[model samples]
Target: MTASPEIQEIAIVTGASTGIGAATARELARQGFHVLAGVRRDVDAEAIRATGIEPLILDITNPEHIQALATRVQGDSQGRAVRALVNNAAIQANVPIEAFALDQWRAMFEVNLFGQVAVTQTLLPALIASRGRIINISSVGGKVAMAAYGPYAATKFAFEAVSDSLRRELSPHGVHVIVIEPGAVRTAMLGRAIATAGELVSAMTPEQRQRYGALVHAVNEQAISSTKSGVPAQAAATVIAKAIAARKPRTRYTVGREAALLTMVRFLPDRVLDRVLAAALRPHYPKLPSVYDA
Candidate 1:
């Protein structure tokens, strides 16, 4: 059923306490949607409330919190049958695939993949009733592989697949599924990734460290600098809000410089693309033996 023009649009945005999630929630509110900002802690809830959006305490992994969110949305006239569900929560720790702990992988997938699925499942009926949209915030890594980001990107690739299947399955129900691939945004996630890389390096065997040291250091420096230079969180959020609000949003939206450029690289010849990526990341080796600085 087509919703009324005056149906009073409502939205639920996970990971809404900071960065992209917080910005998206505020932008949606500015667009006149009643937004439920899903946050994890009391401080974050308070912070979100300060923006004049209702903040709900939500830890995506916890079933009770999910239940509470479902119950609340199911009951509120102003907020029920939400018109949009923005899945923006994710956790990234840069452990290598070989050295990555099974439990850590499970935990990342729990919040990044399973938790999102559980939340979407709980709200699917309401979303279908309202002919709503589901927006999954993925990453450039979802489309391209990287050395140390396998665990995080694995979840995003899963999310992309989820969005595709959902778009096909829910079209008959008048529900739309959109995936947003953001290349880089200024957020704490990068800091966490860098810290995780450091931790992993410290715990590595000498041979392992020797093999990966220069490359890891280069990546760490790149991540730190990029965190400062990447597009602001608000820019990404604005794009997401646009995708959600438009009547005919694209199935996938790629945001930021890296996302746009790297996606184009996918169409290039394999040998050319390989050379480009390798050159971009390869560490500089001295042409001649270096003398030690006294």
Candidate 2:
């Protein structure tokens, strides 16, 4: 029931300037779809233009941009049907909830969850017409919350909820929704996180700094270690490509060794998993400020 190539099979990939998004754009282009890759900057657009993917200036968090992207795509889609929508745009902040600001929380969700919802809503008609697929790129952290990962995990956890509801609502209409959860993919984002760990702590107030010092160090160390050992962005992209082309895809496609392991971990009893997680993060525990400490 998928749209045929004669209809100009169009695929929109957001956040396609680099990492999994870029890889997915290239992979989809290779699969014969006219890939409209969304990038925030003209420089990024210029870089990918040579690869045959049309660069679109889209900032998912911006309503105007989202509307424009929809309008522009709808126009270019005159002879085509939107065959796939890859929602790969996302942002991550690493501070714990206690240290995280409200604006930070809102901003993260704006890009990671709300913005995607807007895109999906605007494109649902095209998706329904083409019997197209919607692919959401989540993270291994989406499966389970970890120490100092609250802000990012909150958005992703909510993403899963949104994806589940969306899948149910779209399935009857022949439009499919799939979630791809990747683990520790080596990307510019990871590189920046590792290189800029100090900045996170530096932003904290004196008391907050003292409270999160060792914990931040531990988390960043583990993050760097994980990124160094992480899967390539192309691996996740290949899985996404397959999912899009699938006649009957699974509801969720968990990619990478870490993601598979996290899936398995989901079955553990709450208490058992609680103990395991606590033990794992014990080495990173810093002295927390308390009444007694004061």
Candidate 3:
């Protein structure tokens, strides 16, 4: 959906501080749409400010921030129609289900799932009015949960479900709901997730630590390895920009080959898939004594 020459179209991208979100914001701007890049910090806002890109201080979980964004879109001084709303804000931490505190789970969900929902809901009116697209940035974790990835994957799984339901609900209204599932993209997120996992591991009980320590270590190592081999953030952003510009965009798109393959393999039998994942993770396991060795 290319923007009309006469009308100034707008594209909103949340989590524009770094990584895929930041890349997408710039890509969309380059495509001729006025981009509203959402960032949490003043430094990020300053960094992303550029031609065709306006940085907005948006914390999707904050009602005031979301409302302000809605107001800005709805009452555009230039009367620009919002062409797309990219729900790209999210957080992640790889920790065992038992080791992650209940509040930690809630906090993650609040940012990853509920935060996206809030922003989407607030902007739905403008989106429907303009017949705009809703691009949700999900992850490969949404399709398959590995060891120590329970909490992070759960939110993504729920997010995918929500995207499906929202797509069906909004189709008749001329709004497009597209989900972008990306594999390990070389980004700061992975490092932050690894650090969070280490902290969680430190907080675990002696028995829990003994049971899951190697698994957590292996997961972190696997993450690091995958990230080293992952595509750059710009590659994912290009895919997203293509989705935004396609006349008949797909319901879902994958950013990397890893994501494409994993999403397909997810349909395999549960036990078989379990072995596949375990096998994939086994190579990254540390050479230390642990429960998996028993």
- Tell me each candidate's TM-score: 0.90, 0.91, 0.96
Error of 3 at 219 (Å): 0.4
- Give the range where candidate 2 is weakest over 10 consecutive residues by summed lDDT: 285-294
Q: What stretches of model 3 exceed 4 Å from their correct place?
A: 289-294
Q: Which stretches of candidate 2 lie over 4 Å from their true place?
A: 1-7, 195-197, 281-294
Instruction: Estimate every model's Cα lDDT from 0 to 1.
Output: 0.82, 0.82, 0.91
lDDT of 3 by residue, 105-159 (tens): 9999999999999999988988999899999999999999888889989999999
TM-score (C-alpha, index-matched) for candidate 3: 0.96
Write the number of the candidate with greater lDDT, choosing between 1 and 3: 3
- Among these predictions, the greatest lDDT belongs to 3
- The stretch of ten residues in a row with the least summed lDDT in candidate 1 is 285-294
lDDT of each residue in 1-294, candidate 1, tens digit only: 233446657789999988899998888877767788999899998887843379999999999999999998888965545889999988887656776778889999999999999999999999999899999999987887666678988998898999899999999999999999998799877887778777877777766666666656665666666567789889988899889878899999988898899878878888888788767766532234321100
Superior by TM-score: candidate 1 or candidate 2: 2
